[model samples]
Every structure is written in structure tokens, then in C-alpha cells.
Target: MLRARLTLVLGIVLLAAGVAGFATAGRGLRTTSVHVGTVPVELVRPDGAAAGGAARPVVVVVHGYAGSGRLMRPFADTLARRGYLVALPDLAGHGANPQRLTEAALDRDLAAVVRYVRGLPDADPARLALVGHSMGAAAVVRAGAADRSIAATVAISIGDDAAAATRPGPRHLLAMYGAFEPSGIASTTEATGAERVVRVPLVEHIGVLFADRTHHETARWLDRALGHHPQRPVIAAKGRLVPGGLSLVGGLLILIGALLSGRTGAAPAPPDRDRPGLRVGAVLVAPIPGELAGVALAHALPNTVTGYLTGYFAGCGAALVAAALLLRRPDHPARPDHPARPDRPDRTARLARPSAAALARAGLLAAAAFAAVVLPVHAGLTDVAPHGPDWWVVALLALAVAALLAGAHALLGTPWSYAAVVALCLPMPVASLIGVAPGFLALISPLVLVLVGLHVAVCAAAGRPWWRTVLAGALTVAWPVAVVLPVLG
Candidate 1:
């Protein structure tokens, strides 16, 4: 009965964590610099000669905090190649300038860039545009508010606070971020814009800049805003469909797997017997001793033997725990005149009963994860080679992970659910530490945190101890913040 209860609690916790992790992963402000001011702007103009001709509309790209202008070079190049005069400027305290971030300092730098671009022979002072990331985006908004010459603005992963509220000059504004951003600040900011405001879905804070979906959408948006059609008209459609397909298939697989796991049932009953409690305890403890012995032997053995001893101790521990659980079961007593009531279904089994809501939530989570993995991989692969893993690979992988999770929940019942939640929550931090594909980590982080939070919330709803749920959420979300916040400044 205790084992069954434990299993139920574990499963609930795991489910909640998985949901939260998926939701909150890759959601944070990111900044980079583009050196386009008095100092030789790091921006790369693909059409250098074109930039020297008649005054063309100047598009100044600003990087986020702690980021170098080099980061914006690719974007500037893209714009420049399309006939716009593009400038990449490093923000104050980023690249070239080591000054700390301050409203005054940033304004001065922006003013300098504006003046420089206006003075350029090729730049048209009448059609100026500013695009920025994170803090840089905020800077652009501030500049636009004060400068009437600015024609359009693109702010990625930035919120409209008091400063943005006052801005009224830009004819068009584009604000974008991942769907699961904790603050939903970007979306809120977009509401205040007078002109067109676009919100791209499935893009996280950093992902807004680099994820192929977001990147292509951004390029198209810019082109339209600039009164030009995209050179490649079907790019956006192709990018959207690819990730969308992967997410749909992955979500379906997860739902099917959950339904197939017999999770939609009531708890099973515990057998009646005088289980040997101490014997069970010994069975659990025995593995520790065996593991200790193995570790000691590994230290004395050759390096090759030591390398191969990875699972030796773990196997021993599992065996001992299994023995303990087996010994604890009570022996059957003689049947009374009336047959004993059937053992009560365990709590986990009862909780496992599939619900429409649970399935929907799981499907959404699976889709997001599917998108997170697929978009970046797609971008990376597509950039390098035309013939690579197709939509099927992404769908299969996402489905496989979801299926594994569902199976783990079923096998471990409720008690192990907590562990599973922890495992699911671990991916973002693990991915962050291990490094995901280029320009992908930002998109992935927020989804991971959201999933972890969802998992914790689910566990709490399912009656797992409140403290455990809170603890898991805190540990999963706080780790990255603790590590990154200090460095961001």
C-alpha cells in the first residue's frame, strides 16, 4: 500500500514538472552589439558600393547587453544584400565601448549612430529604421520616442514599460518572443503600438533572432514594412509548415502512448498479509553494501576495469531495493468464511485514468518540445545541407521521448512519477550546459522552465506534498537564473 501511494505521488510530480519545464524553457532577455556609430560599425554591408550611392534608407541593428556587434553582422548583411543601407552598432558597454548600461549613455550612442547614418552619402535620412534585441530593443524604443526621423522599429524580446509608452514616432513596430515567456512583456508592449505589431509564435527571447522560423518571418516582415516583396516568397510558408508538421505528429504520438499505457484506471488494492518489515528493510539496505564493495574493488583494479565498472554499483543497488520490496509483502492469511474483499486499487492507478484535459495538456507540451528540437536542428541542417533528416525524424524523436515518459509513468506507477518529472525537467539545464545547436538555446530554455513548472503544478493538483512540488520547481528554474544573472550585468 505504501509503495502504491509512493508511486502515485511520484507520477503526479513528474507529470507536473515535465509540463512546467516545457513551458518555461528558453525564455530570457538577450543582448548583442552592432558597431555602427562613429567607431567603424561592425556591420557588414554586402553591397558596399550601393551604400556609397544616393541616400538609401538606413537600418541600424543594435545588439543586446554583453553581446558584440559581430552578432548583428549576419542580419545587417542580409538587409544590406537586399539593397537597404544597414548599420550594426555595438551598444554602450558592449564591444569597443566598456561603459555600463545607462539610459543617458545608450541615448548618446544611438544619437551618434543616427547622425552618422544620416551623414552617409548613401543613406536616406527620411526612411530610417532601428532593430534591436533585448536591452538593445529597449534602447531603440527610447530612441524612437525622442527622434522623429525614425520611420520603423523592430523590438525583439523587449517589454514596453513607461519609456515605451511615450514613444509615438515609428510608423510600424514589430515585437516578437516565445509563446511561453514568463512575463509576456513583449506581447503586452505590442498592444501600445500605433501601427502594425506582429507577434511570431514558438519563438523564445533569444530564439526570436536566430530560429529559422522567427528569422525568416522577421525578414519577410521587414521586407513588407519596407514596401518590398521577399526575394523568395515561399520561404515563410516552408519554414512554418516544417515545424508545424513535426509538432502535430509528435503531439499525437504522446497522446496515443499515454492512452495505451493503461493509465486511465483506478488504483489497485494492496494484498493482506503480515509482511516482514525488517526483511524488506534489509533487502533495501543490502545494495548499498554491495555497491561500496564494488567501488572499493574498482579503485584497486586497472584503469580499463575501472572504466567498465560504471553500472556495477547501480545494478547492485537496484537488486537490493527489489529484494527489500519483495520481502515486505505480507503473506496471505487463511480465508475467512466471507471471501476477503478485493484489494483496493492503488492511488496511482486511480489517478492514471486518462482525462481529456490531461491529454490536451500533454499534447501541447509534446508539440512545444517537438518544435523546440526541430526548429533549431532544421535551421542548422538546412543552412549546411539541403538533404538532411526530414520532418519524420523530428516527429519520431519527440514521439519516442513522450512514449518513454508514458511507459516510465506506467511502470513506476505513482511513486516514480516524481522522479520522472525531475528527469524531464533536467533537459533544459542539461542542454544549456551541454550546448544546443547555434541560436537554439534561447528558444529551448523557456520551454523547459514552463514544462517544469507545469509538472510541479500538476503534482500539487494531484495531492503530492506541496513542499516537494515547490522544491522541484525552484530547483529547476532557479539554477539558470542564479548562474546567468550575475554575468548578464
Candidate 2:
């Protein structure tokens, strides 16, 4: 009863906080979605700007790898409120754009969006600025260096590309990063010898995108570079989303706890013949074959986020198979002509079979959680809804995730063991992913870790048995990946 009460009270408070955060993040700005040719662009402007009035400075905010126009909302709102028109595009192989992500394709799509925004009736083409984060930063630096018309450029968390584009740029350049970012980021930013190299303290790669100081500094830099001055240059706080997001996650965990504690009786543990040490060893060593498989298939896939995810899923599946084989029991002795009596249904079968009522309840819970988390993030942070081919990708990936999770549980005989393996095994796969795919993939590693932790928490709370928890976790993880990662052909 106490758990139930906690779930009720805390969930309500957190959800309310989340709603409030989204409501106030960009309260006075006008945001709209439009197509600039084939590219999808999100345009933000000051609410009072007239359609045919005097032009405003245009700042094109570019998203990093696996990011969308919506992901840069904080920056867009900041610039828009300061009387600058902000155009954010979903680059090729990201968000709503269906094209694959390649250097050439991203360059083409970004150029097209820049031209489109520059030609807007309310935009001052002469006062254009470009601000990009990570992958977007690299692209914009290159773009700004190539085009002298761009008056200012802000590259946040840029990579080595800054070095090549560093020389001979007369325009204003500010290379900014989070203090917590890797040393390489600082080195590259400093190498550019940009007009200014500022680090926003107490934030890291993705956090910097939403940091209050980042927004303030970026808007101020752009203002000075473009010769625009508002009556007040200071920005209102945009950090409400931080606590709001935390509240939502906290609420979800509490609710899961309530469900776990409310159970009338403990579920029976499944039969396991493997020794504890062998099972643990299997889990620990699972990633080796996965890495090998991922490396082998890397060249076969496109270089987009979706492609990387496909490789990830493949690697996970390989790891699951390896672990299962390692934990497989030796056959019992039998007479020469007679085969051993058929054993009970395998672990996979047990995991695949859940009562209809349990499945329905798990599905409903997953949907509700999805709405609670994705809706607010989409409204206030980024584009986070699956579209087009991404829906199918979500389904396929969910199946793979479910199988791997259920297999791990069956082999290890406990959710905590599976969690231990995940925690230990995550870094290697992430490192391999960065090595083979986009460097910006490294920026999202922390998010992936949190996601896996959330999944384990959910399983612990919804501890009916293996199948329901696996289903819920698989759906939750798969949906976000599908929504955030691009669909590339």
C-alpha cells in the first residue's frame, strides 16, 4: 500500500513537472514545420514578427548525428526570442529526411536548407549565421569557411574537421564545448584558433545542447557578430527541462516498484542446469563474437544511424547465440539405439510464452510510458516519433532485443545477472561502434547506458516473469532508437 501511494503521488508530481517544463521552454516563440525542397526544416521566429515586415537575421541551427531539427529547440528558441529567425533542418538520414547520411549527402542537404532559409521573405540574407553541434558543427565550419557570406559560425563539440577548416576565415568564429567533453574535442576546437573558444562548465556533449550558458553564450556571440542588439541580451532559464525530465524518470521507476511490490506471490524460478560461474562467464565473454560479427558486417551497411543500429542488433543477436551455446547442457547418457527422452521446452520457448493478460498489461504499460517520455521530449527537445520505414525497423529491432534479453535471463536465471553483464559489456560495443561508425556515436554512449539501466529497473519492478519484462523492455528501447535514429536506404 505504501508503494502504491508512492507511485501515485510521485508519478503525478513528475508528470506535472514534465508538462510544465515543455510548456515554458519556448513559450513566446512561434515554431512551425515546413519543407525546404525535399528537406524538412523547423522554423522558429519571434511571435510578433510580421509576415512582410523588416527582415531578421537568419541563424541556421544544425543538429548532430542521429539528431533532428527539433533536438536543437533550446538554441532555436533562444535565438528566435532574441529577434533572430532560426531554421533547423533534419539533415539527410536523420529525423524526417529519407536520404542516407553520407558526407556528400549531408553537405548537399545542408546547403539546400541554408539557401532556402536565406531566401525567406523575413530573413536578412546578408546577416546569416550557422551554429552546429558535433557532426553538425563539422559541417557548418566547412560550410562557413567555404561561403564568405556567412557572417558568423559557432561550432560546438567539433571534431578534427575543425583543423582542416580552421585557416583563412575572416568571419567571426566561436568554438564552444562542454568542459566535461573528451580532451580531443578541446584540442580540435583550440586548433581552429577561432575568434573565441569557450567551454560551458558542468555539462557534457548532449547536455551542452540544452545548457543555459550555452544558449546565452551562443545568442550573445551571434548578436555581436551580426550587429544586432536587443533591449536585454540576457536569456531566461531553460534548465527546467532537466528537473522535469528527471522527475518523469523517477516517477516511472516508482510506479514500477509499486507493481513489483504489489504482487501477491513470488513467481517460481525457471529451471537452470548451468553452474553460476559458467553462466557468469558466458555473459562476460558474450561480446567478443558480437564484435567480430559487427566488424564483418560494417561495410555492408550504410553509414547512417539506422545502419549502425542494424549492426548493433546483429551483434547483440550474435552475442545471445554465443551465450546460449556456452550455457547449453550436455546430453544425458542414453542407450545406443534410443535417443534421450525429449527434454522440456527450451528456454526460448518459455520466454516466448506469456499469458494473454500479462502480455496485454505489459503492452499497455509500455505504450503509456512511451507517450509520457516521448511526447514531452519531442515537444521541448527533439523529434522523437517513428515515421515511414522506421516503424518497421522498430518492430524488427524489438524482436531482436526481446530475444537477446529473454535469452540472457534464461541462461543467467536472474535479471540482476543480466544487468551486470550489460553494464560490463556496453563499453566494448560502444567503442567498437564509434570506431566503425560516426564519431558522434560516442556522444550518445551515456544515453545508451541510462537506457539499459532503465530497462533493468523496469524488469525488476514488473517482475511477473521473464516474458512480460522482456517484452516491455524491448518495446521501450526499440521505439526510441527507431524514433531518434535516421532511416537510410
Candidate 3:
């Protein structure tokens, strides 16, 4: 019983970790933006001048992937304050525009913005400059290469591979990138025709564009490229990594996997006495009971299935503990050598032999049903819609079920029952492959199935009774679904 409880707990923990991982991945994807087209183009002028300018140098700011022109507002405002006319334009495939960002489309859109800026009465068509961040930087580089009218250029957190070898005209070119930006590594390696290169220390790819200091530094670089001598180099102190974002989540997963494996050893051995002889009836009925129960439960209490599953897992845990205690009793037989010591006589001889084996097989089938429900629920919680209850709960319940199943097996001392349970648990991965909503849920389904299977096998080996085994199997299958349904919904 104690073994079974422990297995259930471990299983739950694994499930929790998987969910957490899914959440982290989803959050990471959400933080980035995807926008396209000309939503709003703001033109700012120095000296607090109103719009409608021409013949003055203009700086055009373009935002990155999934980002909007709004992100470039601060940069535009700063340049405007510095006596330069700033034009912030939304690129293709982002911001107000529903289209995907394509090279041909972006070039056309950028050309239109340039025309708009040039038409401004206060702006100088001869002194046009272009700036971009990330994907935006790539677009700007491509634009600069094609349009020689651009007098100067600034690429922030620019991708190295995307950098253009052909410099636009003899005009000044300034390249600024953060040291920690993975994309910047490519920038440094790529041969940009720029006469000068400015590398900023300690700034990450994203940070170099977003951080205030980095922005100021970028501004200074622009000034230098424009023939203005700023007092200091435009660079800020290296920034630190954000602690509680995607990085933290990844670290947590590594830590949890390591801790769980170390604490929970391999599955316990099955007692030899409980080994069942070949029986056609037991084999045939192995999968039917659990499938029927799972289907019935899902249909009858569609809304409350998750809760029912949780309760079932809890009961399994209790059974495992009880089985462990019973097995440890002084009266329980230790081996076949002590057959005369009737206190723990082999019950297999009295009971119809195949019946016990049938029950163990049924338990395995139940675990399979539980896994099918739990996996989808787990995926739904983390991937389909993220909410809290955390992956820890799922892992705990799975481990508990595993422990109960193992304990029962130890008590039963039968091989056929244990084998049946293992087989039933094995199908989880196959079921998961068919489909899981919210996509990312599929990532951890395999792990959950494998762990649950191991738990059932251990319990069957421990010679646990048919009733206890069946209950544990049912809970193992059900608990995760119950816990995740509310959050997923």
C-alpha cells in the first residue's frame, strides 16, 4: 500500500512538471508580437514643432516581429526631441494589418512610408535615415540596400545572416547590437559594408532595443553617424537576465526531473507466488472493465469527470497503504517453505485461480482509461488555456497510483496479473499520438503514460488483491482529468 501511494505521488509530480513546461513554452510564444501594414504613422519634429515638415532629416523606426509601431513610439519621440523628424510605420504582417510578413510585401510598404515622409513639408527628402529592431532590422537592411536615397542607417539587435553586404550609397552606416543577443552574434560575423561598427556590452538581443540606456546609446550612434559629436559613446551598463520568465521555467523543469528520478527508484519486484498460469478468460477480459467504466464516467459526469478521477486516485493511494500494512503483518506467510504455518496460507489455492488474475488484468485496463483522460486534461490545462493548480498536483497523483498498484502486486504474488497491468498501461502513448488540443499538451503525454504503466506493474508484482488493484487503476486514470478540467475549461 505504501509503495502504491508513493507511485501515485510520483506520477502526479511528473504530470505537474509537464504542465509547467507547457505553460512556460506557451508564455514565451505569447510575449512576442506579430503585426503588419500601415496602421498609424506618427511624425515627430524637434523643437516641439507640429507635424507637416519637409527638407529636414527624417529617421524612420520599424518594430520587430509580432510588434507594433507603438513599440517604436519612444524611439521616435526621442529622435523628434533631438531635432530630427521621426517617422514610425507599421510593417507588413503586423499591427493593424492581418497579413503575414513577406519580403516583397514589406519592401512595398516601406517604400510607401518613405514617400509619405518625403512629402511632409518640414522633412528633408535628401537626409532620410532608417532604423529597425530584430525582424524589423532585417527589413530595414533589405530596404536600405534597394533604396540608395537613405542617407544613413541603424540596425538594432539585427540578425547577422540577414545583414546585407551591399551598403546603400556612400552615406554613413551605424550598426549597434547587444552582446548577449543571439542574433547579434551573426551581425558581428556578417560583413556589413558599413565603415564603422558599434558593439554594446551586456545588452541582450531584445534588451538592446527595449532598454532605455540601449535606446539612448542607439540614439547617440545615430547622432555620430549623422556627423554630431555626442559627449559619451551611446552604450549602457550590461543588463542582467530577467529571473522569472522563460529561463526560470526551463530551469525548474530540469530541476524537477532530476529530483523526481533520484527520489523514486526503479519499480519494486513482483512476488513469485502471485504469478498466474496462462488463462484465456483473464486475458480476454483484461481491457473491457476499465474501458466501460471510463466511458460511463465520462458520459455520466462530463462536467465532474476530473473531480471523480481525483477521488479515485486518492482511494487508490489508501488501498496501497492498506495492502502494505497487510503484507507486513506477522501472520502473513513469508514463503512457500512455511505452508504449514496456516497464518498466511496461499489464498490462490482456495479462490478460483483465474479470478484473481482477471482482476489484476482489469486493474491494468482501468489505468489505461485513466491515462487517456488524464493526458488530454493535462494538455488542455497547460496548452489549450493556461491557469493554475500547477503540474505538481498531477505528478503527485500519478506517483500515488503507481505506488498502490505496485503494493497490490506485491501482496497478490502473481505474474499474470502484473503482466496484464503493465500491458494496459503501455497504450497511453499510442492514444496520446492521435490528438491533443492546445497542441503543446502532446509534449508530455508520453512521460505520463510510461510512469503510470511502471506503477501498475510494480503493484501487480506486490500481489495486491483484485479489488484494490482495480480501484488504484481507476484512480490513476481519472485524477489528472479531474484536476485539470476546471483550469482547461
Candidate 4:
């Protein structure tokens, strides 16, 4: 009854919080689905005017690689409150769009958004602007350079193709880079005579979008250039709440699961497995190299966040596998005449190889674990896998990794959950020491925390102290957040 009440209370609180946020952030904004030739785009328009009003200025806000434009509501609302129309379109392979992840495809889709927004009957084409971050910035440069009629372009935390973004044009440019943007690349610093370059302090790549300076500067530049003096900028706190709201909703669901189960969890066996080399190596030595390799490979991989994540997980996976292979001590068979009793726990017995059932369960549990954690992060915070097929890949990857853990008995604890947690817990310190950028880490941090809570709650409710359910859940989600997302961003 106590557990039931706690679960009910938490669930109600989270649900209330989410609804309040949805109401707050969604005040004047109306979301509509439009297509630029079968490529669906999500447009967030101000509720004020119809087709007959005085032509309003339009700003197309583009998201970074693998990002959903819907999540850019904070930036969109900033511009919308100032009497400008904002169109946020999901580039190919992101958001609700069904295309595969590719830069060339994104550029084409971005161009389509510009054309569509320009054609709006109540929009002033002369005041049309493009605001893009990271990959989106690159997209704007490409589109803006091709058309000189654009009034302004704001490029934030740009990529390598910035040179293409620099063709001398009549269009005004304001380029800003975060202080710790992992990709050292930036928009042209040598003023194009028409461009304004300013580096934002105390931020990294993802932070640029939400930074106060970014909001202020972007609005100020657009208002002046577009010839509109709107009201004093009222930075809405709800911008931060939208994603948090989604996470809260996910939490509510977990609480529901717990209440239904109505039992406490069984804890896993303590770490009794031998071979410190395997355990220590997986925990201590493997993460640094895996993370470093992931970051390095992110740049070299195809210019997609998905590709970078693949490289990141690949590195971490390889490191863990290598550690197991090197540290495992093979067991010798006993003589046939003196065969050991099957039921006895022999001190000299070989490390138990995981059965097919164990691997499958681990895979399924791990997938659920990752999905539980990532559901909110992707839906609210980051753009890891917002669409259908892309989300499936995340599940598949989690399953594969969990199965691998089952196979690596030398590294995994006898109960496995204890081993998984130990190995997983060691990465954060290394991540901090290497300076993975707080902006990037903050995106998934809440989701991770929520997963931890859910894991504990579910374990406690089910009357099982076994860590498999909890650890499997953690690994599924944490693999991408801790191992993949940070490296890519």
C-alpha cells in the first residue's frame, strides 16, 4: 500500500507538470503539418493573423543533423513573440520526415522549406530569413548563397562547409560559435563586409540554441534588419519545460507499471566472480579509449549524428570485447571418471557461458531499458531517434549490446546486473575528465536520472532485488546517452 501510494503520487505530479508545461509553451503557437512535395514538415505558426492581414515576416528555423525542428520551439517562440512567422521543418531523415539520413538530402529539404515559406501569401519575401544551428547552419549557408534576396542568416556552431556559406552576397549574416564547440570549425571570422561574427562564451555546440545571448542577439539582429520593433523580449521559462514535460510523461508511465506490479524486487548476487583484470579493465581502462575513439571518428564519419553514434558505440563495443578476450581465463575439463556433480557449485568450474534464454532476455530487457530512458530524451530534449525506423535501430543496437554482455561472462558479474552497473558507472568520471561538454551531457542527464529512479521503483515494486531488470534497463538507454550522444554532439 505504501509503494502504491508513492507510485500514485509521483505519477500524478509528473502528469500535472507535463500538462501545465504543454499549456504554457503552447500558448500562442499552433503546430501544423505541411509537405514540400511529400516531405512532411512541422510548422509552428503564431495564432494572430489569417491570409488577409498585413504581410508578416517569415523565419525558417532549421535543426542540426539528426535533430527535430519541433524541439526548436524555444527559438521559434522567441522569434514568434516579436511578430515574425517561424517555420520549423524536419529535414530528411529527422523529426517526422521519412527520408534517410544524408546531408545532400537535408540541403534539398531545407531549400524546399525556404521556397515554401517565401511563397506564403501573408509573408514578406523581402524580410525572409534563415536561422540554422550546426548542420542546419551549413544548410542555410548553402541555400542563402544560392539566393541573394534573403534579408538575413544567423549561423550558430557551424561545420566545415562554412566556406560555401561565405560567398559575398547582399544578404546580411550573423555568425556565432560556442566557446567549447567540439567541432573547432566556425563561420568565416574575416568579416565578409556583410557578415557579423561573434563567439559566444561559456557554451558548447548544443548550448548555443538555448543560451540567453543567442536568443537576444538573434532577435535583435532580425528585428533591426527586417524593420520591425517588437515588444521587449519576454524570455519564456516554459521553453525549457517542453522537453522536461515529455520526460515527466514517460515517468508517469513507469510509475503506472510499478503500481500494477505491486511487489518489491530481489537484489542480485554480490560480485563473487574472480579475475579483477576483466572487471577493472572494463570499468577503468576501456571507457576513455572508447570515448576518445568515438569523438575522433564522429568527425570522420558521414556528416550525420546517427553515423557518429554508430562509430561511437562501435568503439565502446570493441574496447569492451577486447578487454574480455584478454582477461578471460579458460577453464580445464575434469577427468571423465571423476566428473563433477551438475548441481554442485564447483570452485574449479569454468565461468558459466550465458544460455540462449539469458541472452534473449537480456536483449529484450536492455531494449526496454534504453527505450525507457531515451523516450523522453529523444521526444523532448535531443534528436537521437525521433522517427519510426530510426527508433527501431536504437532498440536493435541495445539488444545486440546486451547480448554481447551476456556472452562476456569473464567481465560480467555472476548475476550480471552488478557487473553491468559497475562497468557502466565508471564512464561518467572519464567523460567529465575529458570535458565532454556540459551542454551535450545535460540533454540526456535528466533521462538517465529518471531511468535510475524507475529502475529502482520497478525493482522495489516487483519484490525482486535482482538487478537484471534494473541493470538491463540502464544499459539499454545509457549505452547511447553515455556512450554515443556525447561523442556526436
- Best model per TM-score: 2
C-alpha lDDT (0 to 100) for residue 413 of candidate 2: 53
Compared with the true structure, what per-residue lDDT tens digits does model 2 show for residues 300-370?
A: 53434445544555566556556666667755556789754455434454546667887788787677555
**Which prediction has more favorable lDDT, 2 or 3?**
2
TM-score of 1: 0.43
Alpha carbon RMSD to native, model 1: 16.5
Pairs that collide in candidate 2 are none
TM agreement with the true structure for every prediction: 0.43, 0.85, 0.40, 0.71
Task: Give the runs in model 1 whose Cα sits over 4 Å from its true position.
Answer: 1-40, 51-53, 167-169, 224-489
lDDT, candidates in the order shown = 0.47, 0.71, 0.49, 0.59
Which sequence of candidate numbers ranks them by lDDT, best first?
2, 4, 3, 1
**On lDDT, who's better, 3 or 4?**
4
Candidate 3 lDDT over 295-317, as tens digits, reads: 33332332333322333333443
> lDDT of model 3 at residue 417?
47
- TM-score ranking from best to worst? 2, 4, 1, 3
Residue-level lDDT tens digits of model 4 in 364-414: 654654565555555456555434333544544454344333333335544
Predicted candidate 1 versus true structure: per-residue lDDT over 343-375, tens digit per residue: 643434444666687556545543443343333
Model 2 per-residue lDDT at 190: 76
Q: What is the lDDT of residue 346 in candidate 4?
A: 46
Candidate with the greatest lDDT versus the true structure: 2
Which candidate, 1 or 2, has the higher lDDT?
2
